[model samples]
Target chain A: MKAFAYVNATNEREVVAALKTDGIALPLAGGQDLLARMKDYIDSPDRIVNVKNALDTTVTSTPEGGLKIGAAVKIIDLYENQQVARMYPALNAAAIEIGTPQIRHQATVGGNINQRPRCWYYRNEEFVCYKKGGSRCFAVDGENQYHAIFGNDGPSHIVHPSSLAVPFAAYGARFRVLGPKGDREIAASDFFTMPTLASVLKENVLEDEEILTHVILPAPGNVRSGHYEVRYKASHDWPLAFTTVVLTMNGNRIGSARVVLGAVAPVPWRSKPAEAALAGKPLNEDTAMLAAEAAVSEAKPMSGNAYKVQMAKTAVKRAIMRAAGLKTV
Target chain B: MSDKEDRFGVSRRDFLKSAGVGGLATAVTSAGVTDVEAQAGPRVIGPGDVPVSLTVNGKRLELRIEPRVTLLDALRNRADLTGNKRVCDRGSCGACTMIVDGRTAYSCSTLAIDVQGKQIRTVEGLAGANTLHPVQQAFCDVDALMCGFCTPGFVVATVALLEKYPNATPEQARRELDGNICRCGTFVRIMEAAMKAKTVAGPPTRQARWGDMGVARG
Candidate 1:
C-alpha cells in the first residue's frame, strides 16, 4: 500500500472535521476491504481517518424491543450476542456465513455494508472496467461465472458483497448515517443503488464525507426469518447465491413475506413476485417451489453464469422451507 | 533611483529577499520543527518513519515505522520475530494469524498501530524455553505438519480454539480451523491433534507485555 497520513479521531465531531478537509480522505473502518483495495490500486487515499475508537460498538435493545447494532460492532461479536442469536436468527446465520473466524474478528458491520464490488475485473489492475471509469465492463463478454443474474441492464455487472445486508433488508433495517450536515436514517433497501452510467463508480448512496453509524431493526412480531447460502466450498468461500426470507404468518396462513436474494444483483434483489406468491398461501413444499420459481422468473443470466439461476431458485426455496420449520431435501 | 529602493546600496534584507531561496529556508526553520518531530500539526505520528511502541511475547519494544506497515512486517523486520509468516499478505490464507485481545486475527492485515494497546500473542509466546504448549505437543504427537510454513498460523488458531472449546468435536474443529489454510493437506492429522490436545493450563511462560494504552478496537 502507498503511504498515507493516518489520524485517529477521538470523537464524531473530530471525525467530521478530519473528513471535511480538502484532498482525498477515506474513513478507515475495519480496513478489511479498504486496505485490500489500496494494495490492489483500486483506491488510494491521501489521508485515512480511523473511526473504530470514535464510534459506538455495542448491541443494545431499542425502545421497541428491537436491536440497535453499532457500526463498529464486529461480525463475530454480533453472532455471539445472546439476544441476537435468540431473537434474530437470520442475522446470526448470516454473520456466521460471512467469512472465516479471523475475518469476522476483524471486520465490522459498517465496512461490510459499504464494501466495494467483488467483480474480478474491477479488482484487477489490467482490466479497467466501468467501475474504474473505463469504457466497457469486461465481465460482460469475458469470464463472468460470478456476475449478476439480475440487475444486468447496466454498464456494471458486479454483485453486492455484503452477507448481512440481505437479512437486514429482509427485516426492514434502517441505517443511521452521519455526515457533516447531521445524522440521517436511510432504509436498507434504499442504501444500495443499482449501477447506472452516471453512478457506476459507487455502489451505495453514502457520500464521501458520510459514515454509516448504526443499523436499527424493528421488532419481529409474529414473524419467522431464515437465511440460507449456497457455497461451493463449505469452508471460507463467498456464497454463489443466497436468500433470506422473512415471513409473517396469520395463524396457519402467511400474511406477508420479504424474500431478498444476495450475490445475484448489484443490490439486494427483493422478489416482489415471490412475496406475492407467498401472500395468504399455506407454507408447504408446493408454495415454496412456486415462490422460488417466481423469485427467479426475471433473472437474465450472462454467458457463463446460467447455473446461478437454478442455485438462486433453490436458495429461495430452501430459505422458505427453513422458515416454515420444514426439512429441505 | 526609485524612492523605495535602498538609498545606500542593496541592503542585506533586500538582497536576501530578492534571492527567494532565503525566504524558503527561513520558512523551513520558523515552523519550530526539530530533528525528531515533523513540522506537521497535532502530536500524532505519520505516514513516514514514526515511533511505535508495542509488546510482543512479553517484551515491550519500540520501533520507527510507517503507518502502512502491518503488524507482521513490524514484527518480522523490526523486532526480529519471524514466527508469524507473511504468506498471502491479504486476509485470505491466514498465514499470519496472531492472538490479539484474546481473539484470532490476521497479523498481515492488522495494522501495527490499530492494536497499540491490546494484548498480542504470537506463536513464539506459546512455548516455554524448553517445553511446549499442549496444542504444540499434540501437533507433534500426531505428526500434523508436513512443511512448517503454515504451522505458526495453525498453532495460534488452535490455541484460541482450545481456549474457547476444550473438548472440541470434529465439526467444531473443522469450523475453527477454517481460518488457516494448509496446502500440505495435513487437515486429517490436524483434526486428530485438536481432539487430543489438552486445555491450556496456565499463563504462558512468555506472556505478552500489555500496557494500559486503553485498548484500540479492531
Candidate 2:
C-alpha cells in the first residue's frame, strides 16, 4: 500500500476537519475492505481518518421502539445483540452469514454497507472496467459468471456487495450521514444508487467529506421477516444472490410485503412485482413459488450468469417460507 | 527527494536508528509531534515513519513504521514474529489470523497503526517458551497438518474458538474455522484436533488490555 498519514480522531468534528484536506482523504473503519483495496492499489488516498474511536459503537433503543445502530458497531455484536435478534431477526440473520468469524469480528455495519463491488474486473489492475474510470465494462463480454443479472442496464455489471443491505431495505432503515454541513437522514433504499456512466466510480450517495454514522431501524410491528442467501461456497464466499422478505400479516393472509433481492443488482433489487403477488394472498408453498417467479421475471442475466436467476428465485422462495414458518429444505 | 529520503527531510535509515528501529522501544517524543500534542486537536501520526506502540502478547512493542503497514507486515517483517504466514494477503483467506481484544481478526487486512493500543495475540505467542500450546499439541497429535502453510492461522483461529467456546460443538468449530483454508485437505483431521483441544483448553491466560474501547452494549 502507498504511504498515507493517519489521524486517530477523537471526535466527529475532528474527523470531518481532518478529511477536509487538500488531497484525497478517506475514513478507515474496520479496514476489512478499505485496507485490502489499498493493498491492491484500487484506492490510494493521501490521509486516513480512523473512525473506530471517533464514531459511536453502540446499539441503542429509539423512542419509537426501533434500533439506532452506530456505524462502528461490529458485525459480531449486531449478530449477538438480543434486541436485534428478537426485533429484526432478518438483520441478525444477514449479519451471521457475512464473510466469516474473523471478518464479522472486525467488519463494521457501515463498512459492510459501504464496501466496493466484488467484480474481478474492477479489482484487478489490468482490466480497466467502467468502475475503474474506463469506458468499457469487461464483464459485458468477458468472463462474467459472478456478474450481476438484474441491474446490468448500466455501464457497470457489478453487484452491490453488502449482505446487510437487503435486510436493511426490507426493514425500512434510514442511514444518518454526517458531513461538513452537518448531518442528514437518508432512507436505506435511497442510500444505494444504481450505477450510471457519471456515477460509476462510486456505488453510494455518500460524498467524500461525509461519513455514514448510524442505521436507524423503525419498529417492526406485526411483521415476520426472513433472510436467505445462496452462495457457491458454504464457507467465506460472496453470495450468488440473496433475498429478504418482510411480510405484514393480517391473521393468516399477507397484508403487504417488502421483497428485496441482493447481489443480483447494482442496488438492493426491491421486487414490487413479487410484493404485488403476495399481497392479500396467504403465504404458502404455491404463493411463495409464484412470488419467486415474479421476482426473477424481469432479470436480464449476463452471458454466463443466467444461473443466478434460478438462485435468486430460490432465495426469494426460501425467504418467504422462512417468514411463513414453513420448512424450506 | 532521494529514494532513501523520508518525507520528514531525513535519511530513512538514520530516522529509523534515531527513532529506535527495533520493534520494541519508547513512545516518540519528537519536538514537532510534542508541539502538535500541545494543541487541543486530534493527534495525527504520519505518512512518514512514525512511532507506533502495539501490545503484542501482553508485551508492549513499539515500532517506527509507516502508517500504511499492516499488522501482519509489521509483525512479520519488522518485529521478527513470522509464525503467522501471509498466503492470500487479502481478507478472504485466514492465513494471517490474530486475536485482537479477545476476537479473531485478519491481521493482514488490519492496519498496524490502527491497532495501536489493543491487545494483539499472534500465533507466535500461543505456545509457552518450551512447550506447545494445547491447541498446537492437539494439531500435532491428530496430524491435522500436511504442507503446514496454513497451520499457524488455523492454530490461532482454533485457539480463539476454544477460548470463546470452551466446549465447542461440531457446528461451532466448523463455523469458526471456516474462514481458513487448507489446500492439503486435512479438514477431517483438523476437526478432530479442534474437538480434542477443547477438552484441554483453559481460560484466557491474560485479561484483555483494554475494556471494550468505544463499545457500549444496549
lDDT per residue for candidate 1 within A1-329, as digits (tens), equals 77877888776555555554444567777778777777776655556778788777999999998999988899999999999888889999999997898999989988889888778987775565667655689988899999899999988998898999999999999999876567789999998899898777678777546678889999878898888899999998999999999999999989999999999999999999999999999998899999999999999999999999999999999999999889988
lDDT of 1: 0.81
Query: How well does candidate 2 score on lDDT at residue A150?
Result: 92
Across B1-218, the per-residue lDDT of candidate 1 in tens digits comes to 23222432322233212211100000011222222222233233477988788887777878889988889999999888999898988888878999998999998888888778788999999999898889998788667899988988999999899898887877888898898899998888888778778544543322222475554453
- Which window of ten consecutive residues has the lowest lDDT sum in model 1 chain A? A15-24
Could you give the interface RMSD of each candidate, to one decimal?
14.9, 11.8
lDDT of 1 at A9: 74
Per-residue lDDT over B151-183 for candidate 2, one digit per residue giving the tens place of the 0 to 100 score? 999999999999999999999999999999999
Distance from true position, residue A134, model 1, in Å?
1.6
- Candidate 1: fraction of native contacts reproduced: 0.24
Give the TM-score, chain B only, in order for the candidates: 0.71, 0.73
All models, RMSD in angstroms? 12.8, 10.6
Q: List, for all models, the DockQ compared with the true complex.
A: 0.13, 0.20
